[model samples]
Target: MNITPKWWHDAVVYQIYPRSYCDSNNDGMGDLRGIISKLDYLKTLGVNVIWLSPVYQSPMDDNGYDISDYQDIAPMFGTMADMDELLAEAKQRDIRIIMDLVVNHTSDEHPWFKEARKSKDNPYRDYYIWRQPNEDGGVPDEMGSVFGGTAWEFDEQTGEYFLHIFSKRQPDLNWENPKVQEEVHKMMNWWIDKGIGGFRLDVIDLIGKEIDKKITGNGPRLHTLIQEMNRATFGDKDVLTVGETWDATPEIAKLYSNPARDEFSMVFQFEHISLTWQHGDKWSPIPLDLPALKRVLTKWQVELADEGWNSLFWNNHDLPRIVSKYGCEGEYRVPSAKMLATTLHMMKGTPYVFQGEEIGMTNVAFPSIDDYRDIETLNFYKVRTENGVSPEDQLAAIHVNSRDNARTPMQWDDSANGGFSDAQPWINVNPNYTHINVAQALDDPNSIFYHYQHLIALRKAMPVIVYGSFEPVFEDHPAVFGYVRANDDVRVLVLSNFTRESVTVDLPESLQAEQVECLISNYTAPSTLAQTVTLQPYESFAVVLPA
Candidate 1:
């Protein structure tokens, strides 16, 4: 059953936010050499693929997402030789490398943009989206940047406005231009030719904008354009390409990830990540909904049952730490984190591990907004501050949910700079490293790190959790969250108590197996009402029964 055709189906992809992972040169920044040094660590985590964030030559306008050059590594990361060494080292460790492909935009400092912005009549002018100002001398659409400010920025040199969905320093590339498309394909092939097996496409859905019609938001163009990419550089390459697509409907997700669709292998969706935000803006919300979380997972469960693949995860570079955002990381940190891991990975899809996630890293609580560095976080703070927003409350909310929440230097150990750097880190290491470092978690058998190892091993050992169809077992029950995954020879029953009080999970008529083996359990709630079993607070159980 060691099939290679479907390696991705059974693969574990670990996402490494390079700047925060490790720094080897004492430059206060993580580099390719640092990643090379940690291949063995990633290998020990049981992940087969490493999805690295952008490492291309850039101005770091958006943390390398705004690529200035597609062909080489940024000076901060290392030279091209260093990248090759890291790639070879990772491959030697049996880990495939997935580079982040930020094709939607290029750095404004890019030679192409520099030349293009010289004049509207330049050959490279059409390489980006440039439009004549409207009758009112304003940008045509009231398009909003995900970061902040107007999506269109006026360029005095060109006497035209250029579109930037992100930072003004990053201009959206015109995918409709054949030359632009060809250049991107060539760049992608160069990476693949350099031995990369896959790509984690950044803002990939934003490619192929509708000409003449201004793109207001996430629409169908995201899908139809990806079709072009799959057809071009990645055609029949036996590779992986995931899109950072938010607000895509379930049907759209299938269209993007369906094997036959030829769009992408999988894409990152943002629906589940929104649960942590419950207030003014989705970013710094006040409340979280656990029951609604189960509902979100349920939709994906049915949406991708036999059609598409889901990228299962809790934390990544964009959102706050999983430990802080999801489960009550303070009160029931151990069981809650453990149960949350069990809750997601055991579902039907490929599991993506964020860096430092295996060690249960939580979000940081900054004493002042001055400590924050993320552009998105700063934009929100500045705008709210200018609007007469309370400086104290804004800083408090930011402490709860800043992108820097996930960007703090990784805690490798309790040593200097959390063992992540020989020099001062670009960002301060979380002060709780003494209590939550990898060294401490790995040493404790019942720690969150160990729980992740158990879940990963079980997923690889049992296809019922990997390839089996996902069916929510106790869907109608409010307190009980359970599911069943049945492969040919195995039926895995996963039941969790998401509530503070114990809840009973009744046995299904088809679940006739009287005996159940407890693969893992954090707590136990009684099921005396149905004469079956109950689960304890924040506890999760994985039982193997007869098919």
Candidate 2:
């Protein structure tokens, strides 16, 4: 398959979870104005695009994911004027802003949902999925919510159960309704016209769910709906569209991202992240299998090398911090963080740097459940406790897997609230912020921030980083992740040690070169690549050789 060059192919994205990013007004939440105030900072960080989490009108259920109004900004996040200012300011810095499009569901407080529940014959009834209860007065199906509990919510007024695959407060939108699709498209076009970049669709795969058939993702009409969506908005424009699809395999990804399909620029697949999920249960944690992780990542790299695109990321608002989950958060935090960045950024994908990730933020272990704010975390606690799980075990799992671990406020300085807000924050800031902050990172030449800056610049300078074909090296190595990216001009050999102990590996004769250019390394640069090389704890580097 022939690849078409696009701007985002070489671009790096920075994701900001709005409420915790920066609180400019001391309102205990980050707003559009706060984001605008940091445009220069983001510009300095070298990210080409900013993928802002949901800032639309919401009741704060699910933070901002359960949107109530599609066109208006939430009061907590500021007004439409603030959003316009952010877009304008980011554009000035050559940074494109992509808002999260959460069409999978809407806050139950939304006008459509409110009216839909008023009476069965309401005109807007079809805007959301509704079904009558079974003969036993039970739910429409045996489906469970992603957060917990039943996916169907009973409405007394309408005498029907509305489908909500997430929080009961978030009713799933009916994509089968042409009017809903039109409304979503119209709203997207409104943002595009405002000069916004594109969209990072939220749980987009669930939009075409066949509820009656118990199919939630990769449904029969999933691609058809996405293609129609592309035609309706951002299809002709030079905009990036990435769909959040937990069920996406290489085959399914091709249907969604292959250029000829006109669906999405790429899809965020969870195969790599799901490696630690034991028996598909996130709360049931297991040791990170380094070899298994390499296999999963290599599969995606090789499978999507030609037709589809990839979204490279380790941390997001919905997942635990990378350093905490996959690296050392203690003594080796700096090197491990840089090592993780070097490994992921060198892959062929549009890499995303979550807020605080550039400076090596780790997961927060809040003492009690009362300190947690994420709906998913709270729900899991309640459900598991009721199921006779010990509170101690649950808290241990929460420390490692809770979404709230990533929702902590950004640590800017050592001052109060980590300089995120003057007053108490909506959630507790990580206590380690005193040392792990932007201020300290800026002062240190060997900080993780500088490492990321160099990596981003490297991506922009080397076409091989973006367009090179990937081939796995040391596929059977226990603790080493090795790969080679090659094109006509150069072959870049990237290697990382995913362990706390020093490991040595022999280089293949094919990868050996007479002359090598050290592109980037987390540790001191070696003079040359010897046949047998020893990598220190969490060490990673990339070197260029003749293709």
> All candidates' TM-scores?
0.94, 0.99
TM-score result, candidate 1: 0.94
Q: Which candidate leads in lDDT?
A: 2
**lDDT (C-alpha, whole model) for all candidates:** 0.81, 0.93
Model 1: residue 187 alpha-carbon error in angstroms: 0.4
- Give candidate 2's whole-model lDDT: 0.93
Query: Candidate 2, 408: how far from true, in Å?
Result: 0.4
Tens-digit lDDT track of model 2 for 216-300: 9988998899999999999999999999999899989988889998999999999989899999999999989999999999999
lDDT of 1 at 237: 91
The all-Cα superposition gives candidate 1 an RMSD in Å to the true structure of: 2.6
Query: Which tens-of-lDDT digit does each residue in 1-547 have in candidate 1?
Result: 2223377877888999999998989899999999998888777778889998999999887888888999988999999999999889988888899998888889998999999999878999999998889999999678878887788999999789998989999998987788988898888888888888799988776784674566534554666667777788887797888888876668878888887877888778888787666643754575666577778889987887777788898888888887777666677878878888888888988899898888888889878777777888889888888988788888887877788988999898889889988888877888988888888987888888878888888878877777787778777677667888787887777887776676766586776465666677676422222337667777887777754
Error of 1 at 516 (Å): 1.1
Question: Which residue ranges in model 2 land beyond 4 Å of their true spot?
Answer: none
